[model samples]
Target: MVSAGVYLVVRIFPIVQASVVTMTVVAAVGAFTALITALVGLVMNDIKKVLAYSTMSQLGYMFLALGVAGYTAGVFHLINHAFFKACLFLGSGSVIMGCHHQQDMRRMGGLAKLMPITFVTFLIASLSLMGIPPFSGFWSKDEILGSAYAWGSEHGGAYWLLFLAGELVAFLTAAYMTRLLILTFAGKYRGNDAPTEDFVEDQAKLQSEQENWEIKKYDRSLGGLKTLYREDEEPEKHEEHRHVPRESPWVVGASLIVLALFGGFFGFVGAVPLGITWWQGFITFGHAHHAEVNWLVMGISTAMALGGVFVAYIIWGAKFAVFMRLYRTRLVQVLQAVLANRYYMDHFYNGIIVRGFMVLAKASRIFDTWVVDLIVNAFGAGTKMFAYAYAWFDLWVVDGLVNLAGYMWLGIKRGIRPLQSGYLQHYMLVLIIAAVLFWVVRYFF
Candidate 1:
């Protein structure tokens, strides 16, 4: 589904290529989307939410590549993204189910020791997603970055900004994904087996645990204009439940392993820098723009990705306390709030667009009842009156006329009956009377 739009643009390349304005707009939108979504992923607490935003960011990269006329690069990233992103999603699901529907990463830790297969496969896929070298994502994403830079060099303008934005998005992607791995699998267990009293104490301090608390009360009223109040319900009873997190089933593990393998090595078939053009040759046909791999761009992108990983490790892994102290500052909190709320897009959609449509629906209902229904009812009453008048005419005037005709016919038959009574004298008399009347009329007139 995510690939459909990119595929459409690729299929209609002639039209897209013909318009510079279109290409510029596509590139700008893609770059913006990639940057924004990467920012959003940095603050997510749910494992799946992080992955979801990551998928959107990757799509932005694909569009960015296409926008820069890097058709092969766009398609290459699409295919590689599918492999790694699918593995990541499946691994997240496996973790969720293994933890008995626990998607909150704060409640998960030290899963690597328990779910070995899942850990290995997830790490491999994450490496590819981070665009680490020798992995599939690195080859494709590097190609896109190279293509963007090359396009910008040939076509001077703000188009060069796209390359910088793509590089920034890559750094953020690596940072957040590293943060995810560290939080979910590197730290000590924070889940059901925790000391009961400490767990209860932590749960009671809702302010400190804003992520869990916010989900329960999603009534984010916008300046007292609208309040989305959810129904009240009883809270779940907490008990000292102890269960060890285990690896996913064999089927899930097997699938992850296969995807991890492809995600790990699939890029070898399309290494443009290495002159392995099997993938680009097949996909680009005659329109392929072959260029020597820009080693400078590759080095810079790799440095950015590795720098991101290092930064995430220092912040989330090594100095979590310091990170939290900074996280609690006013500036960071405000930024966090905005990102957590998805930039208030939901509020705008629900409060404006949805409510406007609802008001239009109500107005339509009123018009239908008062105007449409009234007109229809008036026409119905008029038809009923006309039908009654027609029935009266049919019963009295029409029936009466028919009865008068029948009576006249009966009288005429009676008057003519004597002439046909088998009497020759009567017959001759009638003939003579008719003949006398005819002669008198003829002579006088």
Candidate 2:
């Protein structure tokens, strides 16, 4: 659910193992997604949206990892990403609650003190996400990049593009994560609560003293920030206190704490710190190429990660006003505008592809409704008309001929009816007359 694309990548990994062409296609698509999502993530202001694009970007890494035949490395990265990203989401939830459900990072400046536990844990997870050292994400991501380099070195010049793309995505990952941390946890408080008390008073105070009023303590350490549960009071009596965001409940904090710890330290299990074979021994796949660490690839990838973070710090942290002024320039404004709109992907889809498909679909529906239904109705109407004609023919033509023959038979029977009467005198007279006539005729002859 977190990174659904990785499962698709895993399903296609076998194809890469089977055919070279499929591997190339998968790798190319993966590289494209990696770059695209990173660029999309850069201009986002919402915390969850940034993390969502980050998820997509991490999925790109997994796909590219599979592309280079790094099945174990890709799976490892998938597992590690799950732990760290879960921490990130939960921490973001904690921040949202503390800020009264504000999701825009622009409205959130300094929250490191307001939600200390969440901040610390989130920072740990962020570091892991950026592939910082001693973190689970670093171990897995390093292996994936190493696989790309290994593939490129063995294959040819074109295959090297996968490595370059992967490394570029890594840098982008660091940049976005660093930007998120700086904008969220390192600036001044932006809330309107008690705006008059510390209104432009002390700009030199440390992070914790200036931003927070509550005692610096984890809520879970004190039974998850308990309060008296009075049953007799009406709901409206304490309505104001109900929305105040306290530390997360122990159940939620416990999960975050556990995941954060794992995110920070789980890499040791498969760490490749001195060309060690610790991780590869456990993998059952017969990939002998990644048996040891490649220092060049690892070093280059780590340096790029650091460089991305530094770049983010320069833009968002050290010289925030200067960069703000820079962004106001026409060229930077245009770039931000394009990046903010996700390169007009929505416009292309909505104005072109979606509209085109809708037209075709409407045409198909009309054909089905009018044309096909009309033909079916015509067949039904024709069948009914033929039935009516057959009924009339049966009554007029067939029955009429039979009835006429019957009437002729009845006429003949009626004419012969007088001969059937018992008449003895008439018959004897007729016989005598007939005999006399016969003798007279004989004498004359």
lDDT of 2 by residue, 1-445 (tens): 7567677667656555788777777777878888899988887877898999998888888888888888888877888888899899998888876766656677576778666788889999999999888788889999999889988988988999999998998899999999898877887756543333332232223223423323434332222112222343322233334433346667777888998998777777678775555656765355443566778888888998898899889888886787778868999888887987789998899889999999999999999889998999999999999999998998888888888889988999999887666899877887899999999999898
Encode model 1's per-residue lDDT on 259-291: one tens digit a residue.
999987898889877788888777883576575
Report how far off residue 246 is in candidate 2 (Å).
4.4
* RMSD in Å for model 2: 10.6
Q: Which sections of candidate 2 miss by over 4 Å?
A: 2-15, 193-246, 274-276, 287-290, 320-322, 368-370, 422-445
- lDDT of model 2, residue 258: 97
Report lDDT (Cα) of residue 242, candidate 1: 59
Q: Please identify model 1 stretches exceeding 4 Å from their true place.
A: 193-239, 320-323, 405-445
TM-score of each: 0.78, 0.79
Q: Using lDDT as the measure, which candidate wins? A: 1
